[model samples]
Target: MAPVPLTVPRRALDIVVALALLVLLSPLLLFLTVLVRTTSGRPTVFRQQRMGEGAREFTLYKFRTMRPDATGPGLTSGSDPRVTGTGRLLRRFALDELPQLFNVLRGDMTLVGPRPEPAELARRFPPEYQWMFRHRPGLTGPCQLHSRSHAALLNGMPDPEEYYLSVMVPRRAAMNAELLAHITLTTVVRYLARTLWYLLSAAWDRSGGSSGRPGGDATRRTEEGRSLCVRS
Candidate 1:
């Protein structure tokens, strides 16, 4: 299948859905903002430069999830001490990413597509992944689905930054290219639904506080390790 063009209809669909979600989720967004401010101190939002379509740079927004004084490489590990208490909760269900709805509204992103890479990472990507730059970055995508969450991916890694750069980036880029090639309305809806399911599952786990999922983290880490090894 050929890659889906960024047609007028697709853009319109993004705008309408993004606007509706922003309106519907406004209360939760406001509450999260206040919570982040009170818990993490001022500067509730974290904005970083990310590469988008045609390698354009744009400010990607998320609820601040790390301490202001924390200093380290850009990559975050499962045991990173910089992640705050509230930040952990926010990240568990990916609530920190809610701010990107505004980006979608502003036309910097889509609800489903290749997740945007940081500017530095984008500059280092191989030519095989260059096709991703032709499309608007997305809040969720095939790469995001296939890969483990940040905690799982970085678990027990000797060097999280190096592991991510050397192993994860290229794998995700290839998946993103594959997703872009066969992208359709049905594919987009499937990806969105899967993302929502994961979010809900994470929320349930958080609420239950480890009812029956013993050793879940270890199992996930093992799976992630195997996945990475397979590609290696």
Candidate 2:
């Protein structure tokens, strides 16, 4: 599939909104920084090498949401032990990702686009999956919300790079391409609203309410098995 060209107007809008969001959220960012420091013990921000448009490498930013030593390949199950108490709160509310606003301002990312994958994962995927490189990576995208479980499966797999390329990446790339084709200010606004709602809902559920467990453990386990297949 060919890369979709970004319209000039859309690009301009992206710049304007990204800059405005950074400025408007500065106080929130500061507050989060202090909270993370007190809770996670310094290094409030985490950076990782991620693939961007044209398969370029860039350092993606996020508020640290895992233990300082919790580095390695594994799926982040709801019950992952590595998630600190405050980290769980941050993840549930999506507050941990607030640092990526800087990525948008840096032009390495867009507010609405395909979420970038770690460069190692990108390298493992095939060329077709590489189509994701056609557009800037995003802080949030279609796949981010709808495919959380699938993403967890992919990320947890032994050869996730291959599974992502063979399965998830192609499908998500298509969705992202479609989104790019229909990009507009109204659509972007709607996407943001939906994403915010989803985050809030998840947070609400986590706060002593119903667990929005989308699938049964059996189903999740099946997906996990498939993830293992990519390696075998």
Candidate 3:
């Protein structure tokens, strides 16, 4: 086999963690799947083609957060009218992304790396940024940790897709390249830890658990995750 950027140990870790998470998160996944079905009416899981390792394409899954018939631009802000109420909650904390754990199990992705581009948008990605296809796209990574910030920027855009390709994509490409350049066991571990914290914090906030104060514990934890993304 060709030597992929993902090392043997990293792949081992990915498999172990992915399996454990699938087993542990199964109940929550079931609940969410049912919730989406009941709330949005069938097709609980959304499937889309995404660009992956070596520029290969594969189906990525997410717990559906939009109406079964909703159709519009792929890039969505929190305010996208197509998003259902359940989906708004799901998107706020990224609960919609939980299904990608299966993608990790199936070797379509790793727990960490650059976020994948939509297959259709892959061509729009600048040729210079094409290097991102080297490794399997990650379930989460450095650039991905800044998703909320990017989404906020996107929310106000006259054209989310244009701003994404022209603005966010360059930043994402740079962050992805930098992280890959210095990838190490320590780097991977840090990313995984930060991701865990991010998920937990986001979930809490979305669940109406956020502290209502500026410098409260919840905000502090979120801020810490933001800082760690810069230096972790």
Report the Cα lDDT for residue 119, model 2.
69
Root-mean-square deviation of every model: 9.7, 8.4, 10.4
Task: Pick the TM-score winner.
Answer: 3
lDDT against the true structure, each candidate: 0.67, 0.63, 0.70
Instruction: Predict model 1's lDDT versus the native.
Output: 0.67
TM-score of each: 0.81, 0.77, 0.84
Counting clashing residue pairs in each candidate, in order, gives 0, 0, 0
Candidate 3: pairs in clash: none
lDDT of 3 at 232: 20
Give me the runs in candidate 3 sitting further than 4 Å from their true place: 1-3, 203-232
Q: lDDT tens digits, residues 102-211, model 3?
A: 89989999988988777767767788888888678888898767766565565556866777788878888889989888987788889988977876777656433211
Question: Comparing candidate 2 with candidate 3, which one achieves the higher lDDT?
Answer: 3
| Total clashing pairs in model 1 | 0
